[model samples]
Target: MKPVTFRNRTWDVAANLHLPADFDPAQTYAALVCVHPGSSCKGQTAGIYAERLAAEGFVAIAFDASFQGESGGEPRYVEDPATRVEDVRCAVDYLMTLPYVDEARIGVLGVCAGGGYAVNAAMTEHRIRAVGTVVAANIGRLYRSYGAAAMLDNIGKQRTAEARGATPLITTWIPDSVEDRKAAGVEDVDLVEAVDYYRTPRGRNPCAPNRLRFTSLANVLAFDAFHLVEDLLVQPIQIVTGDVPGAFGSMQEGRDLYDRVKGEKDLFVIPGATHYDLYDRPEPVARAVGRLATFYRKHL
Candidate 1:
């Protein structure tokens, strides 16, 4: 994996492009840009996906989102839905410059919140020929009182506070250190698991940043992840989700997105798996990525 700096049409984007040991410059290979979930760096599940893809002969990338991880952006963790989605477009622009890449066969795969960002990018960017997601979150639905609706009110207050010109409050996301985890116990798979995986050693990496800005909560609310889901998607799409009890919500969202597709599409529900399980577990993720690569090879 060689490091490169990409941009979001603004600041420099930090990324890792993994080339297989047998990579042949004379041959054009399919490429994939694997986007990390919110608050996570490229080194998490996305990196796992990238490594697997590279092993399978595809040039793969794992990149940090603009405001999170190692990427440079203002007010660290000031993540916005629009900006995050556009970042994918910027990644595609960067991918086009790679000598061994097949620009026409570029695709994207994202996990959790990263899934939303990838879908948004594929909806708007024709350069991305195929799209795939795991533990896909419809950020908008979750924002607009999806499940665990109570949290929205607290988030709304944070938004209002930011709007009133208050100092951008910095909030802690994952446990800052091992001490923090000892103080608090791991609970559900949503926010806690997010903080746990991206912030702790279980999924933490060297490139990720530790601070999260509160204002990003407000910005994420405005992001309708499925905004263009219905009419704008013109490429191959595959949505994979776990079939655990609470995870059914994502399955429903996947179904909703699938029904609106106007092109080649697929949906897979891995039974008895939970949301976080898809993040890095070999079995479920392999199935999803295999389906994704196959879909792209057939379509693009």
Candidate 2:
């Protein structure tokens, strides 16, 4: 894996480019852009998938979104859906400039909320030939489940305060630890697994601080990643989600996305796998990567 950087609007996106062991610069290869989950960095699950996909003979890139990780942006840790979508498009642009990359065979794979952003990007970014998602979580719909009305009101107040010179409010994506979540009476299986994967050594990375600007909720609440997908999303899509149900609702969202997509699509549910299991867990991730390799091979 080679560390790389590319321009995304005004920000610089830090990324890792994974290539096959026998990779030859003279040969063009199908490529994939691996998008990390919200509040996570490219060095985590996204890098894992990129490395695995590279071993499968594809050039894969796992990138840190602008305003997060090592990427350059102001008002750091803001999780704006529009910016995230544009990051994917910019990654595609970077791929197009590579001599060893087949621009016509480029695809995208996103995990967790990144999955939602990928689908949103592919809808209008016809340069992407195929779409793949793992444990897809639509940020807008997911936040709505947590009571959008109250959150929106709070965000409005926070934005007003920040405009008046108050320090920007910051919030962690999940509790500091599983024990903290349990003590707070939040025992959702998916959330627990999320805390485990993101906050602990199990999958934590120095670049992934797991924090977001509280006021950023304004855009997240209004954004709909799947909006107009039925009409604009014509690329072949392969969605993989765990069967385990939780507060995150990614399982149901994946099914909903499957039903709404008008073009050729396939949904694979990994039995006994929870939402976070697809993040770094070996067996489940292997299953997801296997399906994705086949899907991209056929489409891209």
Candidate 3:
């Protein structure tokens, strides 16, 4: 994997480019942009999949979204859906600059909320030939689950305060620790597994600090990542999610996306895998990668 940087509007996006062991500069290869989960970074699950996909003979890139991780942006940790979708398009622009990349064979894969952003971007970004998602979560729907009206009111106050010179309000994606979660009476299986994967040594990375600007909720609440997907998402898509139900609702969201898309699509449900299991578990991830390799090979 080679560390690289590219321009995404005014920010510099950091990424890791993974290439096959026998990669030859003289040969053009199909490439994939691997988008990391929300509150996550390129060095985590996205990086893992990019590396594995490279081993499958595809050039893959895992990148840090602008305003998060090593990427450059102000008021750091903001999770605006519009910018997230645009980041995917910018990644494609960067890939097209490579002489060894086949611009016509580029595809995209996203995990967790990144999956939602990828789908949203691919709807209008025809440069992407195929779409793949793993444990996809629609951020807008997830936020609405917590009651959008009240959250929007709070966000309004927070934004007003920040505008008047108050420091940006910060919130964590999950509790600081398992003990904190238990103390808060949070027992959701998806949240529990998320803590295990993101806050622990199993998948933690300093770049993915797991914090978000509280005021960023306004955009997230108003944005629908899957809006107009039925009409605009014409690319072949492969949706992967665990069968186990959880508070995050990604399993249902995956089904919703699969049923709504009118184009060629396939749904793969890992029997016992939970939302976070497919993030890094060896067996589940391997199975997902194998399936994705086949899909991309056929489409891209």
Candidate 4:
């Protein structure tokens, strides 16, 4: 993996780029950007995906978000909706520079929050020819408020708060702990996995900076990855989720999102697979990666 400096809009983001062996500048190859889920960095699952994609002869990159991981931003771990979207755009900007790249064949792969960001990016950016998501958390309606009902009421409140010139109120991101999981009851749909993925060694990386912060809640609530989702369907989409009952029941999210799609799309549900399995398990990741390669081979 080759580490490089990447700029997202005004901010500089640190990213790792991987190219296949026997690569040549004279020949153009497809490119894919791998985005880790929120609270994660370029290592872990994104690293695995990047390596796999590189082996398959596609240029792949995994980057830290603007404020998190190794990237630079103020009030670290303080996330913002606008900047995150800009981060995605910036990633595409970086990919266009490589000698062996085919700009028209660029694609995106996002996991969890990264997945949501990828969806939001493709809807707005025309340069991305194809998009894929794994265990995606595209929850704008639930987050912007407090939960579901609060979001509805909070919209006007958030607007009023902004009008009043008060600092935005951010909710507490779920804690990273096994006990927290037990306390929260690990319901099928609640985003308990936030804590699970961010805290556990199964997904944790010490090199990825930032601890859980409360002040950035406004960004999570306000950022709607699927906003203008219907109008944003300019390219093909492929979503991967589990049929399991836990973690937002991504099965429903994937299905509903698929129904909303007006373009070419595919959805796969891993029987007996859980959300985390698709994140790193060898079999699950391999299956999704194969589908992704095939899909991109056809579309990108």
Candidate 5:
């Protein structure tokens, strides 16, 4: 693993570059760009998968989105859907510049919300030969779950306040604690696991602060990762999700995305895994990495 920095338009994106143990700079290798989930950083699950994929003989990169983690951007912690999609494309651009990277064989892997961003990126970025997703969650759908009227009303007020020079409101994606989750009617295994992963030592990283600008919801609520998936997503896709019921409704999301794409695709469901279980859990993650490696090997 090595630290790398590259420009994504005006911002400097920070990433970790992972290479196979026997890697030779003299030879070109297929590269995979891994995008992290919302309120998450490149150093968490994305970094883990990038390292695992590198061990499978691919040059891999896990990068921080422009406005979060170590990356440079203003109004920090804003989670704009457009920027997330563009970040993947920017990562691809960085990969194309590498002498040891095969530009024609680039692939993308996105986890959680990042999965949606990956799909969105692949919709227009033809350089992505193959795409893979783990526990995919469409940000637009999730935002809609909050109810349109209430969200629209809140967005109106927030925008008005911003126009008056008020600071951006901030919110955390997960509950502050297990008790808080239970109180909010969200005491499920998936919510608990996600809270632990982001807030505890199990998968915590200093760079992942788990906060987002509340006003950014307006952007996410309007953007759909699969807006034109049926017509634009022509590349092979591989989606991995847990079979168990959990937060984010990943099984149905995976199925919906799989059904829309006309290209060759595969949906691999882990029998007992939940949405968050695949984040850092050893067994499920290993299984997911194997499937991703096999798919990319055949396509990229």
Candidate 6:
């Protein structure tokens, strides 16, 4: 993998390029953009999948979203869903500039929260010929279900604080440790696994500090990643998720999304795997990647 940069308006987004070991500049290859989850960076599961795709002979890229990780933006750690969706387009822009990349066959693969943004981008960006997602989360729905009253109150308080020139409040994405996770009263098993994955060696990364700007909650609550997928997303799509208890149970969101998509779509379920298990767990991730690589190979 090699470090690279691409312009996203005023920001130079930091990204990593994964090229196959036998990559030849004289030969054009299919390309893919991999987007990470909201609280994570490119170096985590995103890089893992990107590198895996590269090994499958596609030129893949994993990038830090604006205002997060190594990327540049003001009001750091802000999770603007609109800007996050647009970042996928910017990634396509950079991929198109590569002489060895097949612009006509460009694809996108997003993980967790990033999956929703990938759907949003494909709804408007026709250059994305195919889309794939792993343990996809419709971020807006999650935010709305997370206690509307409390979320609203927090947003209001943060807005007032920002008005007074106070630093942006940050929301912790995980407990500091396993014991903390157990003590935090987390009823959802998926969230328990989430803390474990982000805080332990399973998929931890220094770049993912497990937090987001408090103001970002407003955008996440307001934006819908599937706003016009039925009308706008006509490209092929494949969604891979686990069928376990809690958030991963049945992947109702993926099923709903597939029904709404007005193009070829498939939902692959990895039996018994939870949401976070697909992040870096070797067996499940390998299964997800196999399905993804096959889908991209057929479409791209």
lDDT of each: 0.78, 0.93, 0.93, 0.77, 0.90, 0.88
Q: What is the lDDT of residue 116 in candidate 5?
A: 95
How many pairs collide in each candidate, listed in order?
1, 0, 0, 1, 0, 0
Per-residue lDDT, model 4, residue 3, is 90
The candidate with the higher lDDT, 1 or 5, is 5
Off by over 4 Å in 1: 146-167, 174-192
Write model 5 residue lDDT over 122-230, tens digit each, in one string: 9899999999999998988987887866988898899899899988788888886666777888766767888888887888888988788888888888888889999
lDDT of 4 at 208: 54
Q: Which stretches of candidate 4 lie over 4 Å from their true place?
A: 142-172, 183-197
Which lDDT tens digits does candidate 6 get at residues 227-281? 8788888899999988885753327777788778878999998988888888888
User: Which is the winner by TM-score between candidate 1 and candidate 5?
Assistant: 5
Model 4: pairs clashing at backbone N, Cα or C within 3 Å: 145-151
- How does residue 104 of candidate 5 score in lDDT? 94
Order the numbered candidates by lDDT, best leading. 2, 3, 5, 6, 1, 4
What's the TM-score of every candidate structure? 0.87, 0.98, 0.98, 0.85, 0.97, 0.96
> Over the stretch 142-171, how does candidate 4's per-residue lDDT look in tens digits?
454347555546656765776699765544
Question: Which digits, one per residue and each the tens of the lDDT, describe model 3 over residues 1-300?
Answer: 899998988879999999999999999999999998889999999999999999999999999998999999887999988888889999999999999999999999999999999999999999999999999999898999899999999988888888899988889999877788889988889999888888888898999888998988889998888999989999999999999999889899999999999999999998999988898899999999999999999999
Q: What is the lDDT of candidate 3?
A: 0.93
In model 4, what lDDT does residue 194 have?
A: 53
- Compare candidates 2 and 6 on TM-score and give the better one: 2
Model 6: lDDT equals 0.88
Q: Which candidate order results from sorting by TM-score in descending order?
A: 3, 2, 5, 6, 1, 4
